[model samples]
Target chain A: MGGSLNINHLLFLGHGALWTIGLSVIALVGGGLAGFLVALGRVSPSRTLRLLAATYVQLIQGTPLLVIMFLSFFGLAAIGFNISPLAAAGASMTIFVAAYLGEIWRGCIEAVPRPQWEAAEGLALSRSQRMVKVILPQAIRIATPPTVGFMVQIVKNTSLASVVGFVELTRSGQIINNSMFEPFLIYSIIAVVYFSLCYPLSRLSRRLERTALQKKPALA
Target chain B: MGLELDFSVVLDRWRSLLDGATLTLQLAFIAVVCGGIIGVFGAIGRRGGNPLVERLCGAYVEGIRNTPLLVQIFLVYFGLSSLGLKFSAFTVAAVALTINVGAYTTEIMRAGFDSIVKGQIEAAEGLGLSKAQIYWHVIIWPGIERVYPALTSQFVLLMLASSVTSQISAEELTAVANYIQSETYRSFETYIVVALIYVALSFVMRFGFWLLSLALFPRRRRLGTPL
Candidate 1:
């Protein structure tokens, strides 16, 4: 308990940082897959589907990710699901990220120029073909910068997984602090690690946004 | 395993939930007002002529934006005590939230500020308006009007984020749910109820903001057009 910060503690933090990345990847992939469907649903021709997707986004957006974590972890356990912390954290993150990414992607999808959609229609393309060959390509270009920006959010939000006892970067710091009694120092290190991870993505997102903006005038 | 849903048990503690929701709203209110003030100044400092102030403001925004709020809350919660400052959990929660939201708000406010065309400010000056009058008539009000929607949404998000203060045991809505569930052994029912309450609160906040917007922007209200 009396020992100061050392290699083992730093090593533990490194391990936790790895998990933070792992959990973020899980969220991005799972959320991306689900968010794609949600984006599709939002833009779908079916009124019911669009309404349903919108409702899901609103509901999830309104509730805090922390509450979702609790509901998935302890709440599910009480109801007899007995989920592991990793599974619960991953599931929660996926649900939370899907709602946000879905909205972002929806905006991207909608941002596709009206003439592009009309052109696809004029080309006698089927609805699926139009989406696959035309609309999505444009949308992907519009989506890239925001998608990268949202990745920073996904990484930051992954810290909430620590509340569910997921042993991510923040939780590991808590554990070290429990023994070393150095909350500020440990948490400062943790914050720095998170900053290192997120700042690059933030910069990349901004750069992509600038390039996207430059390309816009040419396309127009 | 059999799944049975019973909300009645959770509903029995509605009074406590109400109290918690009230506290959540209070925390959100304080943070919004305080963070918003910080945001305005931070935005100004970023765009202002002083290179040092601009860089410092930029660093603050970037540092806050990149790190997780949980870590920031911990930093405030524990970092303060380590320095021998005594404060309540609620105070700590509010301060952390204010700091967190201020960064995002600064970015949004800066966008709002940037939307003001230079010609308008010059025109105000050509009309011989004082600096304070120019700022109010040409800058601040118009800037806020342009970004009202974004600003309100950010505030609503702040309200939702106030739930994180529960981690510090601030006795907000989420923390209250934690306590009730632990006592009642109705964790599922409790969180479900709490989540719905949050949804309701968000709607309430949105409606309130809409009403405020209507009153604040008479031109938009009269013309029925977005600024």
Candidate 2:
């Protein structure tokens, strides 16, 4: 046991890493769709719709993701709905990611120059055409960097899913640490693995942010 | 889909939840202050031009930025104890949180510091002002003012993140809720109430930061926004 590191341990960690990526994808895609709606709602013509979306964003963004996981896990059960860990984690992540992403996209949408909106309206484009062809096309450029930046947050946050008994990377690391009694080695490796996954995205996001800043006027 | 919801069990433990939320806010408030000090120092160290200090600051910022808070908590709490260094869970939790937030605060402040116009600093220097005076008047205060919103948001995020301390059994909000749930066997009601409380705490934190900004930066409050 001392001489050779356990291949099985390595294998289990590898599997957990894959699930971490899987959970991230689920959160990202699901969150992106929900966020799109939230973003639209934030900019909706109706004041109630805008306020409803803003409240949703504020409530979700203020609370920690871990609490959301708990509510989704146990709250669903208490109301007598049978739920799985996957559904709980996935649902919680969707809501959690949507809040932040929606805000991010909202900023992007609003950042589209006022004149451009006027020009689109002047051109007699339909509302949908104004959004898709004129507005969203421009907002996507402003949104790319922060959107990618939040992805790193999403990946890091998925670690919290472990507490609800979803055995992702951190949970698997805890399991291994429990047996091997190697807190330093196990957590160090876990941190390194996380670093490896997140560092590139961090660098890329910063680069995007810098380039975006150079091109766009600062928005308060 | 077909069950009764009862708040009585959790409501009986209202005092416990209140204290927990109080502890959570206190932790966040203390960490923001302490971490701001560290962040300012780290920013200076990175820009200080001393090779070793710069490298050390860079590594510290990157290291903390890259790892998950849960692992950082473990290394500080369990790993250190394994290596014969001993401390209470609360101390370890605070230390870990401070270190984590300090790095983020460092990066945010660095951006603010970098954006200060060269002309302003040169003007301070041309007035026979000492470097320390120049930094205090021109750099630190204004930097904090410019990045006030970003810093407040990060601190709020830190407040939310204090939940991770439950992993170390630090008796913070999430930990208190955990204990209440175990005692009351009202897991759903407990978490729902706690979630709402966290939402309330964040709103309060935002209001507090806004008030503090007014007191700290009268120029900003009077003048149009700086950033």
Candidate 3:
């Protein structure tokens, strides 16, 4: 086996990294939209809604993303629906990310203090107004550091998308490794690329967390 | 797809699914115990007086944390074959997860350690307490109690992350699902069932951790409050 690193390999990796970014955005945006609903559901006026959302979170959190991916890709086929790898991975990531983001956002919403909810309710605001105008705006600030920290997790976790043949950075590395049979070198480079992508977000998240802790004496 | 769904074929393998879930729990249980020890030592090592020790500990945490667990498993499983060590998939998966979770535990424990006031240590010292005694009574227990929730969540995540070991053919729940799907041609039903099992398993783990917390931290029960 050849142990060579070349321009073409670098180009392939670059392409893979771009796909990784694309997929992360898809997961975040798609998940974010669905998660907002779940978060609202979690704190809904209706007990049934809250219970349903809680069940959703519990079920999704209990399962692994890898299994979700398999379910999306192979499961769809087994059910007589033909789907692409992008569909499978994106769908899996969305479902997985929604549960986590829902829980995160739910905590943020609840962290806005009981008084704020009372004040908004006393102001004759509707349920929607209390959320959109009062609670969510405040909750987002509380949610920032953890959300950013979770971004690092999302990026690293895209590596799992490779298992379903999504051809992201990790899978691209696996492809090269198969040809070169250089597990150590290829995987190390891939790891470095992932570290470069993740470490900045990690540092930023920690910094934001520290700053928030200092300023927000009323932190939940 | 407009479709009727079927689970009978998948349900036929319930025995295997139960075994797989049991295996997953066993793997996570072993990793948590092994990793908790490493985490405690790693936490102590980070705060130890030796500069080399601190650097060594820091590097270990960062090296393991920054990389993906899948790669870590590959490294432990395949990367070791290059170095002439042969280990079972179960061992490799457990070792990799232990290493992965230990780094996170070290980070969490460090935060807990930092929360302990200097006055408490001084009080321990003023009472003629030795370093070991101070660590046990003043440092370790309180620190662990403070971060117990975070630690339990991490362990729960580890239980989920154990699914990655399917790649190494670790006969865990995900792996068993893989095999069953191939055999039964019921990938959807198989994964759905396996996913349900994981949900139940995680709930059980969380409940068990909650019980362990109440038992281990007397302050939790006596005070009826968090430490």
Candidate 4:
């Protein structure tokens, strides 16, 4: 029996690629909002909040994303709630990305020089006002490069959503392979698609990192 | 109906779980060691080899870095099989993991190499050391010593990533979890147990790396300063 690759398969993969991009966006926004809270909690003056946030990061970082995906997919259903695959994948990515992005943002936040904090305090600004007006603005500048770098990770990770039955690029490739029996070509195409999506962000991250390095001397 | 969890069934398969964990560790160990070797040479190539070699190394690192490990695994697995090369899943997983992690290690090691000041190499040359001696003493050892922490964490991440090999039916921890959960119908319990095992494994690996660094880099241990 002979089976051939066709335009229909390419269109299916194209649709899947869109879903992949869609899932990555969902993870980015959802994870970004939650991770922001985590970053703040990590740097919070309250001892208990700091400890809880640190614990959350440790627990999530210690566990693999695959397990988290599985838990959200099967565990929620097991607990008597019918969970959709997209919801499970998105929720798991949110939880997973929040941990990593929280850690990265924490580093960026802390990288804001000590003198800036002191100057803000010297200005008689309230703690909230100081953070909003001084610390966060500087931290955002430091955070941009790494945050863009993490976007590549988020995009690559959306492939894992395929495991829980979301019809993303990788899963669509698998579906096509099941019918066409052409694993190498289809998977290579999938890899190229991912590379195209991720390489730009990687380049941007590297460029930003370089500029950040260059900006340090000017700042000083 | 309320949720009730029972891990007893999963817990009863502790021996199989242990075997799977051991396999995961073994797979990770092979990948790290092999990848480290490739990385050191690759770093050197990128840093000092001919222009073509440097370009090739750069391409390899960028290519691997920009793709998901899942697809890479599929490509390697099918690519090899389609080429009429028959290998076991375990071997293929190890090969793919080594290749995947090697790209990352190359980048890290290249950074380490860049941080090796030119003056250090000149000093080694001033001492009339041979090329091999200068490379070993002036460059790689210290470069690695400085980047030990980064290297350790990378290897730990590699270990965690080894779970992905389960998709290829390489009987690692995650694959075992899949089987157990399917058999017992306690998916949550199985994955929770597997997750805890992974956490424990990472901690063990981190500790082991610390011990190893202490042994390998006497300067760090004695002087309490990075190289």
Candidate 5:
């Protein structure tokens, strides 16, 4: 009840900041893989696969990530999965990120000109080959800006993991505040730390978007 | 351990869930309206001739956009009390959500404003329209219409994000689920039901926005296309 902010507190926060980065990496990689599949499913020729993917996106997009975290952490524990807070937070972030990234990538894939698809088909390429050889190379460029932008979302959303007791940046702030009894000062620091982590990515995403727009005329 | 899914226990607490859902909607409604207003002014300020106003607006947008809402909520929830200003959890939650969503709304609204071509403004001026008239008809209305879909999606996302307010104990639907699950010891069932309720709420919000768009943008309605 009578503690002041000190070096120890800053060190604790630095440690938590590292975990935040680690968890974000886990979510980005895992969610990127799952989201790629979801994107493919959305663009698939099979009607059933398209519907399945659409439903998944709808459900996850509709539900809040906080609820998903609670569901994975406590719901799974109740059903005997009994995973750690890190696992639960990681899985929830992956599921939530997948829905949004899948939608983003789907738009990217579809943004490839219709004529290009016809040309690939005219060249006697299979669907997979068309995707790999002709479509994806172009889609990747279009996907870069938004994907980077969504990374900012992923970084900020990791704060919600503290609810399940994951010792990330936010949780570390809470822990320190528990001792310091200084909410405003502590949370202000936490917000600054988060801003430092996110602002660069936001600038990068904007730069990428500008470059992408500038290149569009050349491509067309 | 064997898993036995039970819905009946959670269903018994439907009244609480309904009240929570109502509060959730109420919070979202207030934030959307207030945030929309802030967004309008913010967009104007950012694009205005005043450099100080533009820089302040820019900072506000960037600061809020780059930070997590949960921390912002905490800052608001405790920041007020520390200043010896007393407010309810609901008020704090609403204020925080409004502030958070306002930044996003500003960005979206600014994009809308930017999409207004210089030719349109020049044409309006050439037609002898007053500055106020030009700002209203040529600038604000069309700008909003251009960004209506993005604004709609942002409001829906704001609704989903209201769940984070439960951490400050605002007694929203998610908070209600936390309570019910603790009481019934049916965490899985309670969250599943709450999740479905949230999904329903999002659908309802989206539908409401669509209807509003129809009423607001008669041109869109007539042409059957979004501006």
Candidate 6:
């Protein structure tokens, strides 16, 4: 076993933390684009589109993310495609996040008061035009705080990517602990680093929620 | 070349998979019960306990919420062992899961508590209800009923999360899958079956919780509204 945790170990962990942040960003952006489509699909005019989207959400939401990751990793290999840990983790995260964000954004979209949609229709705006110009603008505002809060879940969940041998923060800590044999100390540092990364987002989410709550009163 | 898919090898290990699934449900059930208790009391502390207790509860919630369950699991696994305490992996997993979910449950319970109308509590007080009676009649039951949906979803998520405890070798479903996959060389099919099992488990739990809410709050059943 390595004698003790050193500056080098800390630096190694710092690198892993950066990767974790990178994975979170990739998951968010990729998931956001697909999730936006899923959200729109759920509320689309066509019943087929709505059923398809709803089925997709149900299937993903019903399964654990770890299984998704394993399926992506091994499933890809079984099909004869060489997959890197990054690609596997990123792809699975996109699928997982899309389902959840789709659900959340769909709620925000539906939360727009019925009167708003009726007013837009009353003005002779096409459905697409009405959505882009009116409904989405309002929905985006309502979706922000919860979206930010979900980011924390995204960050925490990315630790699972370590299971795919992705060498994120959690995996980095495991590597260090393997040699150091000081699981408590190494893992504690790992937890603290995660807390530092996530707690501010949590606080910001709560703050945004409070402001949103306050604004609702004045809006009413 | 055409790719072939097979499930026979994995299916042959059904007995072990069933055992693992049972352990997972048991672990989740224990954690939910213990965690639910912690959550109710912790919510109370945050809402009306002494300021010090309030701050500690707040910190506990924030600390656990911000970090990952994976890290929390590791900490619990290693932290306890460092103190020279020897316990089974199952015990450790359940304890860690309980502590982790308790914080989340506390937050949900707090929201439930907040949704209780002030006038209702006052009504309870004006009716000469004792403090404990006010807590039960005015605060706790109705609050939980309001947040029951949130609690159900969280508990389902908790069950899925228990798969992570397998990392510490807890002998849960994921761990069983890992072993079978390695042995059968059927990683993809193994995980697929396990995933289906999890989805099934979630559906079962959802239905169970619905039935539970029906039995727990008969007033809601009768009126179709919060009591």
lDDT string for model 1 (B1-227, tens) is 67999899889899999999999999999999999999989998999889999999999999999999989999999999989999999999999999999999999999998999999999999999998898778887889899998999899989998898888899999999999999999999999999999999999999999998888889898898964
Interface RMSD of each: 0.8, 1.4, 1.3, 0.9, 0.6, 1.2
Alpha carbon deviation, residue B17, candidate 6 (Å): 1.9
Give the distance in Å from residue B42's predicted Cα in candidate 3 to where it truly belongs: 1.3
- What local lDDT score does residue A14 receive in model 2, on the 0 to 100 scale? 87
lDDT of 5 by residue, B1-227 (tens): 66699999999999999999999999999999999999999999999889999999999999999999999999999999999999999999999999999999999999999899999999999999998898889988899999998999999999999999999999999999999998998999999999999999999999999999888889888998854
| Shift of residue B165 alpha carbon in model 2, Å | 0.4
Candidate 3 per-residue C-alpha lDDT over B20-122 given as tens digits, one digit per residue, 9 for 90 to 100 = 9889999999999999988989999999889999999998887777778987887787778888898888988999899999999998898888789999999
Candidate 3 wrong stretches, greater than 4 Å: A217-220
TM-scores for every predicted model: 0.99, 0.96, 0.95, 0.98, 0.99, 0.97
DockQ, all models: 0.89, 0.69, 0.72, 0.81, 0.92, 0.77
Scored on chain A only, each candidate's TM-score is: 0.98, 0.94, 0.96, 0.97, 0.98, 0.97
Model 1 chain B: ten consecutive residues of lowest lDDT: B132-141
lDDT of 6 at A77: 77
Model 1 ranges with Cα > 4 A deviation? A217-220
Span of 10 residues, lowest total lDDT, candidate 6 chain A = A211-220
Candidate 3: which docking quality band? medium
Regions of model 6 farther than 4 Å from truth:
A217-220, B225-227
lDDT of 5: 0.96
lDDT of each: 0.94, 0.89, 0.90, 0.92, 0.96, 0.93
Give the per-residue lDDT digits (tens) of candidate 4, residues B60-140: 999999999899999999999999999999999999999999999999999998899999999999999999998898899
- Chain A accuracy of model 5 expressed as TM-score: 0.98
TM-score of 1: 0.99
Instruction: Please give the lDDT score for candidate 3.
Output: 0.90
Better candidate by DockQ, 2 or 3: 3
DockQ of 1: 0.89
